[model samples]
Target: MPVGRTRPAAAVFLANLVVASGLAHPAATASPYLLALAVLAYLLGLRADRAGPALVLFGACAALDLALCAVLGVGAVHWFYALSLIPAALLLPWLAGRYRQARLALVHEGWERARSLEERQRSVAEQARLRERTRIASDMHDSLGHELSLIALRAGALELSPTLTGQDRADLAVLRAAVSDAVGHLRDTIGVLREDTEGEEPTAPAVEPVEELVARTRESGVTVHLRREGPARALPPLVDRGAYRVVQESLTNAIKHAPGSTVDVGIVRRADRTEIRVTNSAPPSGSPPAGPPPAAGRAPGHRGLTGLRERVLLIGGTLHAAPREGGFEVLATLPDQVNPERVRSTGEPREESGSPASRRLAVARSGARRRFVAAFAAPVGFGLVALVSCAYLAHQLTGCVLRPADFAAARVGQDRAEVARLLPEQQFRYVPDAVRALPVPAGTVCAYYRSNGNLLDRVDVYRLCYAGSRLAAKDVLPG
Candidate 1:
């Protein structure tokens, strides 16, 4: 399967399982109602609807609490405390999903833009190649064709002259024959150049077996020696191609620049890697002569070497070429397990390595992996943070909601007792004065009786309440 689809499906499944388990055991209620809440929370968390899922989750939690607890309305009242969590659980995931989708869309759009740019570049390259071919054809026609035409015209004029003898006419005929041969050779050279410019046929299948390659080279009037250091096994195609190109280019170089020189080719195969080396001796005179170097950006037009490099690189191999011990040498090594047929079918020679399609596929796979990592990381991180925050808020709500009611009941009982002990005549002045003088800690709300023992107004003097070591709600009057 493509990488993009596999990871997200796994993440959704795992998240559902965790959310369900968390909701089921809220405060030791083992009732099936609570279990049903867990299942509902899992479903809601996984789906796309934000408000609906959150409402359903909240309702399920409240209903389960109501059914199990003996207190009539305590569960329903407590449900209000859970309202704060709805936004975090539902809205956060939806927003994150939207953000992720946007990010993926942006990446795909960028890739498409890049592909368009590459197509433009390829078009420009093809135009440049065509222009170069035209220039070469024009130069060949002007130089070789013009020279042959002039030679033919002068020879014809000489043969027709009145003073010319039979022997002179025969010499002119031989000269014409030589000029014709020159024109034919020039045409053949031009044809080869044209074939190269268009996408011409491949040279030939690479000769296998070092002996066979050496024998083939010998037939073309060049002397070649083949050497092997280890027992030979059938090599991978990439290895074979690299070795063949090294030998072929080395032999061509020898014939062009060091005519009549002997070539030495070596093949060595080890358990881990195979190596090929080709060397040709220096020119006969033993001293390097100076001449104009090959044209700018042209390396003897050796397509074989270029293709060999592509083949090696496709299979994670390496190649090297340089002067070695008074001769030029090319060397290459390839790993053992590479499929030779696949390398040949894919390794086309161009001005660069690999086709555009292969590179695009590689880039796509890399992008998908990055997206997958990001997809899981965001939600898992957010879910953990939400869960921690939810537990903390629930704890705070328990204290905020239940503790105040307990304190109120305690304070009412104490106030009733204080009123019962007060005397009617003395209570008016003394009772109010005593109540006013009583100390209360922070967060204490108190009701005090007047001297006459009737109900007095409530005081939200929580700041006046205190315990000895810890601050807590305190009554202004004793029970």
Candidate 2:
């Protein structure tokens, strides 16, 4: 399904079909009908677009061929030509069909691949859009929320002023109430647009969490009971960050909806993992009104625990936050190494206990080389064999149109007209100097005549070496 992957297979199939057909060399070496057969092969297999006419056309060609062989007298050349054509006729069309189907499959696969890439691109763009919206929401909540709170503060203080009349005081109180309601409504609206599932940062704080993170929450007036297990030790950056975020979000939630709640925070460290647990008692400030949950949380409209869920899950941790025993509890367990990027500089690379690196690399290279040969050897090997076969057939098929018996009437003092009758057509052609230099004298004008199968199925050129209208040497020469 990769781009341009179908080209080699199609090319090989097409090359085999063409080479095997023997139509490339259409000289006398190859039968004239082969060219016709080549045309028929492609037309019958591919161009006709219907089977009935193709079969009829094939039958007609075969009948005509057999009749011609019977009438003209069959020979080695005829048999070889017929033998070669049989396989090509049957197999070339099938090869053509396979090639056409493979091409279609390749095109369809390419389109599907393009569609998948487009889908992935759209998904990436959507994620970016959502991330931008989250950033914008966070920005609005921080800056605009502060300004709205300031407006309510100023309005409330104005209502307490001695210079203000009863109606003015009433109007100031109403303005403060409206501003408070607007801030609450803005928080709810922005919360809907924010999606915390996207893990923006791959790595978190590159150090262990100090006591200060928990201390700050307690300072906000929540009674937090802290519990610690195992010897206190520095954790991996990913695990450390995941643990801190769990405590941070849980404490924040307890303070927001259930102020004065007794929060019980626990941290348990082990060789392979670190765990964090936060539980809170029934709130001294009393619980807030029930509402619909945000994305993933026990209570509705609680975005804090929902955001923490993503943070915990991103670090390959498990988190559970729900109401338990008339109070809320959040628990998380983080692994020491979530991913390769999370491992610290001091972390040792894990390998198979006794395997050598050189051995592994050598094995991989051997496998790759074997695969390369397996992929390419067949096409290359077949092409060589096809070329050799074609060349040999061409050699056998090629011969002098003249026969050795045609030169039997030539004599030492034969008349020119008589000799001319005995000579084959296309005589007096050029001959090589190696044989021409020996028999024919320099001053005597000479004529070249070629013949086949006089010696070892090879072509021999006969030169009627004449001197003063008398034959001097009429010896057989190599072509």
Candidate 3:
């Protein structure tokens, strides 16, 4: 058996030995077999989780033990002691074992719960770090990419100077080439920083006003329109930055995909929310669509929009990009007051329902609750069973007890029917053989009764001898 099983077994054996030492009288030859049998019964009870089987075993053992005691001619004290063994040796040990099982189950469940929480915390932390890193990478790509584009544009303008030397023109060409190479390197670095995420956010500290952004796009040869509504008040940093990004990405997409197409940008700031809408017309009839279509026709699969959506969502906002009419449109709505910290703290996605660890923890917690209930309920069940058993035994013993007055009233040669009126309904079954062996008249059958109703005493017993139907004799045997 496992160690857990073994300890209860040892406890049961020791309890049985304690009971047997006081009650199980050795045979005349001083044999120890009866004590061994009592110990075995106690161990058996400890191993039985159900009360039905354990109670049955205990009842059988008690019957067998009392029978042995009667055959050996032991006293009423031995009978009482043997009966005490039922609760002390068997039920107590069984209850203790059950309690131990519940305690162990609860401890194991506690450990499982702790492990599950730790794993979830680790997952949340890892996801938070990844999000932060991707956002930083996106910021670098936007700010750096814009600066490099301006440098290349300036270098190109310098190359067209009227009085430029060949060496100066060569230097301008080299600077443009270097700027292009740096843009490629920056794209590669941004891809690395995005990890598996489709896109990232922009973080340009220098705020470019909407008018300036429109002028810059016009300089790049893109036809653009800008409109603003509502009060022109200072916006939160997050909202202002997000608004700039929406316009910047929209103009960039228009320049790449709908070159020479008319672009319209609208910004409407209400008391509660800021709305941005960007739309670009179809390209010239012969021009092919520029850049690739978003994967599965989804906005998030578009790299720029994916990062844009992330940034907008972090600021408690929403973004939508899709093809509309003969042009593409991007719409964004941002709340006036951003709570990015709250969003970042709570936005980490989790798979509690689908996670194996979560399921295991749930099961462990359920089992622990059940065990706790069993721990409390098992003892009460045992007490009820014991109480009923004791009540039944008390009833049976009460019926078998013979009062001293009834024994004294009996006379020799009285009719059996007349003597029967003074007798209890049942005989005391554990009357010692030594008493039974006492000399009596020939051809007499004997019936025994406990001398008093007291359950725990070793008082004398009353034995009545009857021949056929007549009371042949009556005697009080020493206990």
Best by lDDT: 3
lDDT against the true structure, each candidate: 0.49, 0.57, 0.68
TM-score ranking, best first = 3, 2, 1
RMSD of each: 17.4, 15.1, 7.6
In the range 1-479, model 2's lDDT, one tens digit per residue, is: 12113333233234334333443333333544444445435433433334455455445545555555556545544545544454455335433543454444445555655565566577766766677667567446534553564465456557678999999998987787787677667677767877755553554435335377667545544477888997777666666766766776666556445544688999888788888888988865433221222235435325555666766676678888789998888888888777754332212233333444434444445544543453356346556766897676445334434556767667777766666677655553334445555645666766766666342354677777667656655777776
Give me the overall lDDT of model 2.
Answer: 0.57
Q: Per-residue CA lDDT of candidate 1, range 103-200, in tens?
A: 56556756775676677677767755664564355345434443453455356556667898899988987786676556545554654655332321
Number of the top candidate by TM-score?
Answer: 3
Flag regions of model 3 displaced more than 4 Å.
1-131, 144-185, 198-223, 227-244, 256-260, 267-276, 283-302, 309-327, 331-379, 416-421, 424-426, 437-440, 443-445, 467-469
State the lDDT of candidate 3 residue by residue for 1-479, as single tens digits: 23225554444444444444444444332224444444454445435455565566556556665666677656654665565534444545445554555456556766876777777788867776786777678877666665565566556667778899999998988887777667556666776677563322323365878799889766765678999899988888778888988887777666545655789999998989999999998776854233333336444225666667877876788999998888899999988886644443533444566676567656656755764576558667767866897898778778898888888899999999999899999998766667767888889898989888887765788889999999998888897
Q: Model 1 Cα displacement at 420 (Å)?
A: 11
